[model samples]
Target chain A: MAETSRDAKRARTAQLILEAAREEFATRGFDGATIRGIAAAAAVDPSLVIQHYGSKAALFAVAVQLPSNNADVAADHLLEVLAVRLGELPPETRALVRSMLTVPEAEASMRQFLDERVENLAGSFDGDDAKLQALLAVSGILGLTITQHFLKLRAFDDVSSESLLEAAGGWLAPAKGDT
Target chain B: MAETSRDAKRARTAQLILEAAREEFATRGFDGATIRGIAAAAAVDPSLVIQHYGSKAALFAVAVQLPSNNADVAADHLLEVLAVRLGELPPETRALVRSMLTVPEAEASMRQFLDERVENLAGSFDGDDAKLQALLAVSGILGLTITQHFLKLRAFDDVSSESLLEAAGGWLAPAKGDT
Candidate 1:
C-alpha cells in the first residue's frame, strides 16, 4: 500500500513539475527562464526537478511539441491525415502558434521545423517548381490550422468533418501539368 | 517656378499624410486612432488632412485597400486572377491583416466581407455542404494571401510567379472529385 501511494505521489509531482516548466518557458522564453524559478513555481524542491527531468533544457524538450518524426510523410498523405484529424486537431496548434508569434526562440524553432518538413514535401515532386507547389499546399494547411484552431472563426470551427476533408482535398493536391 | 514648387509641395504633403495614416492605422487600429493625431504625426495641419481626405473614415477608405468591386468576383475566377497577380501582390495584405488583428471593427468588416463572398461561391455548388465547401476554399485563398504576401516566409517569397500560379491551381478550383 505504501509503495503504490508513493508511486502515485511521484507521478502527480512529475506532472505538476511539467506544467510549471511549460508555463515558465512559455512566459519567459528559453534564455530568460530559470530552473529554480520553475521549481519554486511548481512548489517542489529544486533538486526533485533536476532528479526527475535531468535539466531545464531536457524539461523544455519534453514539454514542448516538436515536429513529429511523422513529418516525413509525403504532402498528399499528410493533408489526408490532417483532414481526417480535423475533428481531433491537436491542442498544441493554438499554443504553439501563440507562443511562436510571441517568443523569438519558438518562432525560430518553428521556422526551422517547417522548413525541413516542407522541403521533404517538395522533394516528392518532379518539376523545377516543386518546392513552390509544396509551399502553396502548405499555405492551405496553415490557413486551416489558424482558422480552426488559433482564430477559432465560427465559419471554420462549425464545419462538419467530412466537409472539411473535402474542402482540403480541392486545394492541397498537386498536378503534374500544374506548371 | 513658384507654382510648380507649390504643386510638388502639395503632392509631397499628400503623400506624407497617407503614409502617416497608414502607420497610425497599422499601429493603433481604427477606433484607437484619430485624424488630428495622424496629422500631428505627419507634421501637417489637421485641416490639411481633412482638406485632402475629407474625414477620418474617408482617410481610412483612401489609405487602406479594400477589395475593389473586384471583390464581387466569383471564387474560381478570383483565385485564378489573384494567382496571376502574385508578382504584384497588394501592399494592403500585411497592413490589413495587422489592422484586422488589432482592431475589432476591421476584423468584423473583414469577416462580413468574406462571408458575402463565400456565400457567392457557395451558391454555385449543389450540395447541402456548399457553404462549408465555400468556406474551405476561402481558407485556401486566405492561406495563399497570407503566405504569399503577409508572412513573407522565404519558402513562399522565393517562388517565381509562374510557379506560384501553377501551384495555386490544384487546390482553388471548385470540384467534387478532388481525390
Candidate 2:
C-alpha cells in the first residue's frame, strides 16, 4: 500500500517537536522548560506536543531516544551500538541528560528513559540481575559523560574512542544470569 | 606539643560552623543557603562562620572530605572502602552534591572536592588512561547512586553491598600507578 502524504506530514511534525523539546530541555532544564516554548520552537501548537506525547514527562522520554536500531542486531553488537550512541549523543540529547540530573521535575522522565530505553537492553544480557546490570552500564556511561564530555578530563580526551571502549570492555559485560 | 585552650576553642567553633554549613548546603542548595542561616544553625554569629572558613565554598571542601586513608590499605580493600563510603555519604554531603549540580556557587566548591578528593585518586592510577580509569570507577558509583539511592530501584536495594561490589569487579579497578 502507498503511504499517504498526511502520514508523512504527521511524522515530520512529531520529529520537529522532538527536536525542539530536546533544545528546550537541554538549555533550560526540565523545571525551566515549557511546552509552549517547545511548541513555539517547533512552530506547532502547544496542544500538539501534549496530544502526541501526553505530558512533559512523556515528551522528554520520546525526545531523548536513540536513533532507530535494528531489531536483529546481536546482543553483543547491541551493547556496542548503545555505548557508541551514548558517547556520540547529539548536543541536545546530552543537555537533556544534564537537565534530568539537575532538575527534580525530570526525575520520573529520567526513570522512564532508563526503563524504556535502557532496561530492555539490560534484559537482553544473559543475566537475572537485569536491573543491577543495567544500572552498572549506565553508571559507566554517566561517569564517562562527567569525564569525557562535561569535565573534559585531559587523559580521556587524549584517548581514542576505540581504545576507551576497549578499556571499558570488561566493565560493560552484563553479569551472568544464574550467578 | 601541648595545645592552648584558645586554640582548642577556635577549632571547636570551626567544627561547629562546618557541621552547620553541611546541613544548610544540603537542605537549601548553594543559592538558597546563606551564611547567616548556617551561623544560626550552628548557634554562632554569622561573622564567626566567615571568620573561621572565609567562605561557604571553602567550608564545603573541608566538610565533605572522606574519613581517612593511608597507603597501608590494599588497592582492592581501598576500593571497597571507597565504595562503602560513597554509599554511606552523610545526609549533608549528599545534599551538598545535589546543590553542586544545581547551583553555580556550589560548582566551584564541588570542583574543589572533586580535585582534592576524586582526581587525586585518579592521578594515582598507573597507566596513561588514568583519568579515564578513575572516571569509569566514578561512573559506576554515580550510576549506582542514581539507581539505588536516587531513584530507589528496589532490586538494587535488595542486593547485598558485597554482591553488588563483586558484580562491579572489573569496572572499578583504578589503574594502579606504576604497575
* Candidate 1 per-residue C-alpha lDDT over B5-109 given as tens digits, one digit per residue, 9 for 90 to 100: 999999999999988888777555455569889999999999999999999877776666656435447665556433445565443443455444334445555
lDDT of 2 by residue, A45-72 (tens): 9999888789988787666655444565
How many clashes in each candidate?
2, 4
Model 2, first chain, TM-score of 0.58
Residue pairs whose backbone atoms clash in candidate 2: A139-B139, A143-B139, B126-B176, B126-B177
CAPRI-style docking class of model 2 based on DockQ: acceptable
List the pairs of residues colliding in candidate 1: A170-B171, A171-B171
lDDT for position A34 in model 1: 83
TM-score of 1: 0.59
Model 2 has how many clashing residue pairs?
4
lDDT of 2 by residue, B10-125 (tens): 99998888888877766555556789998999999999988998887777666555434445433354344334435665655465455544444444544443443345556566
lDDT of 2: 0.60
Each model's lDDT comes to 0.63, 0.60
TM-score of each: 0.59, 0.63
